[model samples]
Target: MNGGNFMSYVIGIDGGGTKTEAVLSDETGQVYARVLAGPSNLNSGSRESIEGTFLKIFSEIKNQQPELFQHIDYCFAGLSGTENHVNKEFIEALFKRLVGGQFPYLIEHDAVNALYSGTFGEPGIVQIAGTGSIGFGIDQHLNKKRVGGWGYLIGDEGSGYAIGRDALQVIFQHYDRNQKETILANLIGKYFEISGDLKDIVPTIYQAESPRNHISALSKVVFEAFDMGDTDAKSILQRAAKDLSKSIEMILEHFPLSNKQVVLVGGLFNRNDVILPMLEHFLNEECELILPKVEPVIGSVIAALQQINQKYIPLQK
Candidate 1:
C-alpha cells in the first residue's frame, strides 16, 4: 500500500467499435502495461459480449501485474455509441465488476475521450471518422457541444459506414445498369461471398452476425481502391471527407473555440491519408492541428485524473 507503487498504476481504457485498448501508466504519463481486448461497446454487442471483454482485460492485467489489483488508483472507460442512460449504466456496471468495485471509474462517450486525448484537456474540435463520424467542441469552460455521433442508420454521415454504404450502392446501381466492368462490383461480390448476381449480397449481409462489422470492413477496400486511383472509390471518399468537413464546420459555427485547435482521429483518418489534408484544406481558418500521439486510452486516463484530482494532467513529453 505504498504511495510510490500506486503512482505508476493508473488505467485508461478506450472502448471502441472494433476493440477496447487499455494502458497502465505512471503519474507522469509513462506507459507501463498495455492491453487490447474485444469490443466493450455496450450498444453494439450483447451484454455477454461486452462484459466478456471487460473480464478478459481484467484477468490479463491481474496476471501481468498483481499489485494493480490493490494499488490501481483510477480507471476511465470511454465507449462508442453511448447516448442514452441505459448504455452508460451497462458500461458502469461492467467496470464495477472488472475491478471488484475498487478505484474510481468514469464512463464517457468515445468522442469526449478523443477530445481529451487530442487536445490534452484543452479546447478543440475532434473530428472522428471511424465506423461512424462525430465532431466535439470543447470550450475553455470544459463545456462540450457535440455534432453527429449518430450510428450508421441515421447519422454517421461522413464516416466509414457512409463511404461503405455509398460504395455498395454504386455496386448495386452498376449491376442494375448492367455495367459489370466496375471493380467495386467484383469487390462487393468477394466481400459477401456472393456468386452469380450482386443482388443477393444485400440479403446475406442483413442475415450476418455483425452486419456493421462487414460494412465497416469494406470501407477499407474503398480507401484502398481510392489509393490505387479508382475513380469511383476516390469520389466516394472525397464526398465522405467533405461531409466530415461540413460536420466540423457546424461544430465550429456553434461552439467557436478561441484556441482554434483541431484534432482529427479514428480509422478513416489513419487509412485515407487524403482525407485529413482535404479536411484541413477545406477548413483553413484559425486552426492548430493537434494530432494525438498517445492512444485514446490516454484520453480516458486524462479524464480519470480530472475526476480524481479535479485538474487537467497534460502528458509531459
Candidate 2:
C-alpha cells in the first residue's frame, strides 16, 4: 500500500506497561496491519525506553509499507501511565517529534480506550483487572470518571498482582507458622521452582526488574489451584472479586446511570467461571455485564474516528 493522494489511513495504538499494540486501518475501519513492541507506559520505563517503543513500532510499519506511513491521516494513542497531565503532554510532544507531526494525533489514558472499546464509543462503565486494576466510565452527559488505577504500590486492588500477592502472603504465613503444607503453598513453590527454605522467595521478588509483572503472572497459578478446588485459592479469588466489585461500585456511585452496561476486561476476567459470577453477585443486577467483544487497540481507532466526527461498526475479530 503506497501513499496515494486519495487514500486515507489512520493508526491506533494501545500502549500498556508490558507491551504496546498498534493497529493500522482506513476510513472504513478495515484493519490493514498490526504490530507489537515493548512497553510504552511512561511510568513503567524511562523516557528513552518509551520513545524507543513507539519508534520501533512506527519504523517497522514504515519499512514494511512506506506508503501507509506517508499517507496516514490520524493517529490515536491510549497509553497507560499517561494519566498525569505532564506525562501526557511530554508523550504528545515526543510523538510529534518522532513522527514529524505529519498526522493529527490524540493521546489519552489506556482506560479511556478500554472504555470505548467495551462500549463501542457508547457511554458505559469498564473495569479492568489485568496486571493492574482500574475502573473507568462515561455517563449519558458525557461526563467521565476514573476510579482506582493508583498503581500497584497503594492501589490496584483486585488486580492480578493483588490476587497473586495475597496468595504469596498465604504461603509465607503458613511457612512462618510452620504449619502443614497447603495446596497454595505447594503450587506457588512449584510454579516458581522454589523448594526448601521459603525465605529465599523474598529476594527473588525484590530483585526482579518487573516485580509487578512477575507477581501478576502468579495469578494464573491461583486460578489453576482454584480449578483443583483449593479453598485457599478460592478465598484469594473471592477477595479479589470483592475488591474489583468495590471499584465498579465506586465508579457507578460517582457517575449515576440506570441499567448501565458494565464491561469486564483483562486476564482476570478471562476465567468467567470464577471471577465473573462473583462480580455479578456483588453487583446484584445493578448493571448489565459485558465481556469485551473487541480489543482496546480497536477502541483507540474508534476514538480517532470520533475525533473527525466519523463512526464505524466494530467488527469482532
Candidate 3:
C-alpha cells in the first residue's frame, strides 16, 4: 500500500506497567501489524528501559518492513505516564526523535485508552484494576473526571495492590487476635515465603522498590479464598467491589455521566466474577447500562485514527 509518494500508516500503542502493545493500521481501518513488548510504564521502568523497549519494538517492525516507518501517518501512545505532564512530554519527545519526526503524535494517559476502548471511541466510564486502580471517563460534552489511581501508596483502593494488601492485613489480624484454622494463613505464608512469625511481613513488603508487586502477588489469594468460601475473603472482595463502584458513583456525581454506558477493563475485572455482579448491582441501582466486553486495544486504535483525522489525512489511497 505504498509508493514513492508514501502511503501513510496509523499506529496505536498501550503502554502499561507490565507490558506494551502496538497496533499498526492503514486507512480504511485495515490492520497491518501488531507488536508486543516489555513494560513501557515510565513510573515502573527507568528512561533507559522505556527507550530500549521502544527501540527494540521498532527495530523488530523495521526488520519486517522498513518502509512502514515512512508511511506512519500518526501514532497514539496511551502510556502509563500520560497523566503527568512532564512524563507525557518526555515520551512524546522521545517518540518524535525515534521516528525522526516523520509522524504526528497524540500521547495520553493509559486510562483514556481504556475508556476509549469501553465506549468504542464514544463516551463512557472504564474501571481498571491492575497493579494499580483507577476509574476515568469523558461525558458527551467532553467533560472528564477520574477517581482513585493515586498510585499504590495513597489511593488505588480497589486495585490488585489494595486487594493483596488487605489480604495480608486480614492474615495479620488473624495472627494478632490468635485466630487459627484457615487456608489463607498457610497460603500467605507460602506466597511470601515467610516461615517463622508473620511480624516480618510488613518490613519485607515496605522494602521493595515497587510495593505494588507485593500486594499484586496476593490478588490470587482474593480469588482463592473466595473459592474456598472464606467469609473474610468474601468480605474483602465485597469491599473492593464497593470501593470500585464508589469510584464510579463519584465520577457520575461530580462529572455527571448519569446516562452513559459503563465498561469494565483490566485483568482483575475480567477474571473476577464477584466484582461484575457487585458492580452491576450498583450500576443498575443507579440506572446505568453495562456493555458485555470491550477490547481496550481497539479503543487505542480508534484514538490513533482520530489523530489521523485531525491531520486532515484523506482516506483515499
Candidate 4:
C-alpha cells in the first residue's frame, strides 16, 4: 500500500453530539484501528470539549498504529454542529492544526456519513434523529437536500429534545386543562428526582443552561413510559416517528427511494424496538429501513477513500 514513501492509509472521523469515532483504513477499504472519544458536537458540548475529543482520538490512533498514522494521505470528517460555515471553518482549522495541512481533507455534515453508511456512495436517504434531527441525502436525480435539524430552540421536530419537550407538554396539559393522569409524569418525576407534583418542575427546567441537555435527557424516561405500556408515551413516540417519516417524504417528494433503502442512524434509533415499528408503520412501503452494517465512522472511511479513489468503494453485498 505504499504510495511514494508513506503507506496509503487514510483517516475517517465521525463526530456526533454524544461521542466521536475515528477509523484508519487503507486504499483497499481495510480498517486498521478504530478509536473513540468524547462528544465533538458543538450543539451538544463546548468548543474546548470538541478540540479535546479530536486530539484524544487522533493521539490514540497514532499511538496504536504509528506507521499507519505517519503514512495517512487523506482524511474525511463527518461531524455535527459543523453544518454551518462558522462551525465548519473552526473545525477545519482545528483539523489542519492537529493533523497538519499537508494532507488533503474534507469536513462535512454528519448526515453525509449516515447516508453513505447505507448507500456506499450511491444515491439514497438517511433520517438522523439524535439530540437533534435531520433528513438528508441525494435523491434519484442526484439532488442533495437537507430537510430539518434547525436546532431545539426553533425547529427539529423528530429530535430527542423535541420529543422530550412534547412529552413534557403532556404534563403541561395536565396543569393547563386539568387533563387525565398519565405515567410520564410519574416516570419523569422519578427520573429527575423531582416531586410527584410534576408542576413543580419549573425551576429545574428554567434554571438550566442553553441547548437544554437537561430537557433532552427526559427522552430516556419517555422510553421507559412506553415500555410500561403508557398510552400517552406511545402517542408521543408515534407522533415523533410520523414527523421523522414526513421528513423522509419531504426529501423524496413522497417518492420511493431509488435504492428502496433508507439508513437510520443515531441514538434515538438505538431504541429501535419501540421506534422501529412506529417508523416502519409511517414509512410503510416507502423504503426499507435498516441499521448501518458498519457504524458511520466506517462510512467516513469510505468517504476518504472515495475522495481519492472516486466511486470505487464497492457496495457491500
In terms of TM-score, which candidate is strongest? 2
What lDDT does each candidate get? 0.76, 0.83, 0.73, 0.81
Tell me the TM-score of model 4: 0.82
lDDT of 4 by residue, 126-159 (tens): 9988878899877666567888988787788888
Q: What TM-score does each of the candidates earn?
A: 0.79, 0.86, 0.82, 0.82
lDDT of 3: 0.73
Q: What lDDT tens digits, residue by residue, belong to model 2 across residues 1-317? A: 32333445778899987899998886556777788999888777888888888888888877777877877878899998888888888888888888856778888888878887777777889999999899998888778889998888998999999998998888888887896388777888788788776667788898999899999999999999999889989999999998888888888879788658888999988898889888877774477888877788888888777766566554443
Displacement of residue 98 (Cα, Å) in model 1 is 7.0
CA shift of 254, model 3, Å: 3.0
Return the lDDT, model 3, position 24.
77
User: What value does the lDDT take at residue 203 in candidate 2?
Assistant: 89
> Candidate 4 regions off by >4 Å?
1-8, 17-19, 27-29, 34-66, 94-101, 139-143, 209-211, 254-257, 310-317
What are the per-residue Cα lDDT tens digits for candidate 3 across 124-159? 787887778898878877677878889887989888
TM-score of model 2 (CA atoms): 0.86
Rank candidates by lDDT, best first.
2, 4, 1, 3
Reference-based lDDT, residue 19, model 3: 88
lDDT of 3 at 71: 75
Count of backbone collisions within predicted model 1: 0
**Residue 133 deviation, candidate 1, in Å?**
2.0
